[model samples]
Target: MKNLNCKNCGGPMLIDPSGTTANCPFCGSKYVLDHRDTDYYRDFYERMRGFLHLSADGQERRRRADELWDSAASEVFECSDGRQIDIRSMHTYKNRIMTAYTARQNIIFRFDIGNEDKADRYRKNVSSIDYPSADTRSLSDFFPRISGGFELADATTLLVVKKREDEYPLRLFGTLSGRHTAWLIGRMENLCCVLEYNSIVHPEFGLDTLYIDPYDHQASLYGGWWSAVPNNTAVNGRICTTRDNLTALRETAAKVLGFESASAARETEDVPKPFADFLRSTPLSNAYEDFAYWDDVLIKSYGERRFINMETDDKQIYGKGQ
Candidate 1:
């Protein structure tokens, strides 16, 4: 019930007791929880009216988000390993809503791993490598592999077997302005991160929503009947970045982002009215080479690329070292 969430996208979060650690969803990050005692929750909820209390607008925004989740995740995609998996939803988040109704269109990616033990190992901590590690290649490297999954994922959201999951302690990721993803940069205050996940719709019309617990860099896929509206689509360019490099660039990035810890969000006064769209999310379409775009301009690959099985450029027509 209580976890950190992306300040920019409002997905899910992981936080440390000091309330300094963070993680986020989608771009700006690629960048970058916990359970306490029951008694602690009782006392916490008893007095905290902060995010627990949602405004009418917030509730509505959540409903719309759920729809988007359904539209995206429900669609299936064929992975490089020859596994046919359904994204099941466009997007989903823990407990996030908006009062101003600022919905931002974003490209989202979902990936499922083949082994649970491997997943758990990756989930245990933020990797020293890149966020969503996938073998240290920038989102650019695997664009071909990710593009290959498009055949099975048409009209369905693009989900893959993240190439970097093998790089343990770095499986989960959220980027804030393309900065250092899992680590905190000096005094990293006034920063915000938003996390969101895809929703699922089954072949039988059953549905469920998933939420990430940044408490550790692990992705836990779950199912349930939830309501959601897909974020609308438009034309936009795809932006690619890595957390490590982004962190260095943000030495003066004005507004920087980090993952979520303890459901942190910006109050109305803290955020400007003009950029509300950046704070909100809309339904996403699977037609994209990636997820939803910022403005609908295509051709640019966003985030790290994915992997595919047989259809690989892995083939060297003339043999190795040719």
Candidate 2:
């Protein structure tokens, strides 16, 4: 049985292999562990991390990204303060890459879409969605694609840099800190926390530490974009499980994108309204109390997503729509 960490307290998870839920050590909250959520992000993370490991394709992709940036750089003109505007995001699909540009503290923005991956999901998500901040383009289209920590385990390195006379955008700059995202859905348990990374070889304050507050959109339960996260989680939060642990993502690109600059600025958290009605769907033991055939009703892991696919074998695949 694979182990899952607490997304709330960032401690070892107490999970029953046969059970669908797990509890947080620091905060005392329960979460449903759905397989789909776990596997999808895991695939996504692995795929992206693979891109970092490829000795042959890495240079080619970076070179191509640079060439594309060169063609678009000419379009940028000086801002009133002479601040430069250049590609901020280089989102690559099978063959094509879409580069987004923003300048002067994000006051101006544009995008450069190139390549030929007709099956490209990046093009679909980013091209049409309405961006949140006025000047910057919205990149939410990849919301379902790059959604969590499973991708982090595969990331043995990171790439960060300046716009080079158009050096390949975002090449060799900083170390990345990522993690598993799904099973770690937030709960009010343990109230324990730590910083975590399976490969931290040095004496760090222990693995990972975190606090749990279900109401915070930035809570481990939801996804946070700026924090280099595909799911909603805050630093110093728990680390049991996440979508990243289970995905098989391929051909990926990301960096410390930016903060408080997109519509997806934070998680949308609130005590679920119709709180009582919503509770009816939760697979809590007492929730099955109202019905006589209670034992037959299984409490799902995570939330509504798994609840729907529970009875039958799962048929969904990542990168196929999500």
What overall lDDT goes with each candidate model? 0.25, 0.25
Number of colliding residue pairs in each model: 93, 69
Q: Would you give me the overall lDDT of model 1?
A: 0.25
Worst 10 residues of 1 by lDDT: 186-195
Give the alpha carbon lDDT tens digit for every residue of 1-322 in model 2: 1345667766545332224455564466677878964454344333332333333344655664454334332233333344533333332211012222211111111212222232133334222234335543322221222211111122211111112121211111111121112211221110011111211111111111111111121112111111232233444565422222211000010111111112222221221222212223322322112221221221222224332211222122111232
Native RMSD of candidate 2 (Å)? 22.6
Taking the tens digit of each residue's C-alpha lDDT, what string does model 1 give over 175-253? 2222121112211111111111121111111001212222222222221111111223121342212221222212211
Worst 10 residues of 2 by lDDT: 246-255
State TM-scores per candidate. Answer: 0.21, 0.18
- Which runs in model 1 stand beyond 4 Å of their true positions? 1-147, 151-154, 159-162, 168-322
| Candidate 2 lDDT (Cα, 0 to 1) | 0.25
Per-residue error for 98 in candidate 2, Å, reads 18
- Residue 64 lDDT in model 2? 44
